[model samples]
Target: MPQTVKLRPYRLADEPAAVGLWQRSWQLAYPQIDFSQRLEWFREHWSGLQLDSRIVVAECETVPDHLAGFVAVSPRTGYLDQIVVAPEMQHRGIGKALIDAAKHLGREGLYLHVNKDNSRAIAFYRKSGFTIAGEDINRRSGAPVYMMTWRPAADLPPEP
Candidate 1:
């Protein structure tokens, strides 16, 4: 892992690398799924989904044009559509950094639907202060998923 990881807004130039990272991350997480086949679809919706959202990308200083990970969040609705981290970059705090950025952007709350079978992600979200509020099925994949959410703590009255 590199000593420095920087976060920035997603640019049109980062499209290919971002799309590639999305594929690689999903492939590593679920080898049974051929994510390469979905590259075109992902590319099509990558930026389209971020139209009213903030897409943040994390890059390693050690390697130029290296995409460590990225998170796409909609502050308007506090919905997090995607958070993908490079396989090699896992456990290096890049994922956490991306999530932190998401939290900052979606201040009202952060909501996301993660695959139910993805225990690693579920656990990570829990550790990051998100809770499983409900469940749903992915319309495209028909996979079971948990609707998780995180809201900043609010101050209570000093005395009731």
Candidate 2:
């Protein structure tokens, strides 16, 4: 049977698992980042921030206890602050599911920044309909990043 994954709103209790997944994903993607600094950054950013930010977790039906991936979005600006999938579970549609869920929330557009050196993410986002809007140097890490956005396609009809 195919694995069933469900995306649900994030809760306070999910922080530990979410942070773990974030750390693991970051390490895998940017091995040069210092572990301590990365953890500290996550603590500050992911802590008791606005709950209105749509943070969703992806959990599998077979391994309900584990989170396969997660996506954090800002409703106001339609910015996808974070999207991470466990390295072992990637390329299996979890990331796409997360993005699809965010799009269904009626966002006018979606935006995110991917490290310029992270070609894997850049390609993935491009495949998912995101286009490079600009580039910037991350203030924290001084890394070059590509800002991407996904707007509603002109060919699609507007919602009633």
Considering every candidate listed, which one attains the maximal TM-score? 1
lDDT of 2 by residue, 3-120 (tens): 6777778878888898998888888777876665678777778873445477888987788668888888888778888889889888788988887766655358898899998988
Query: Which pairs clash inside model 1?
Result: none
User: What is residue 18's positional error in candidate 1, in angstroms?
Assistant: 0.5
TM-score of 1: 0.92
RMSD per model, one decimal: 4.5, 2.6
Q: Per-residue lDDT tens digits of candidate 1, residues 22-90?
A: 888889899999998888888778858768888999998878889999999998999999999989888
Model 1 Cα displacement at 26 (Å)? 0.4
- Position 56, candidate 1: lDDT: 90
Poorly placed runs, candidate 1 (over 4 Å): 155-160
Q: On a 0 to 1 TM-score scale, where does candidate 2 land against the true structure?
A: 0.89
Candidate 1 lDDT at 129 equals 93
* Number of clashes recorded per candidate: 0, 0
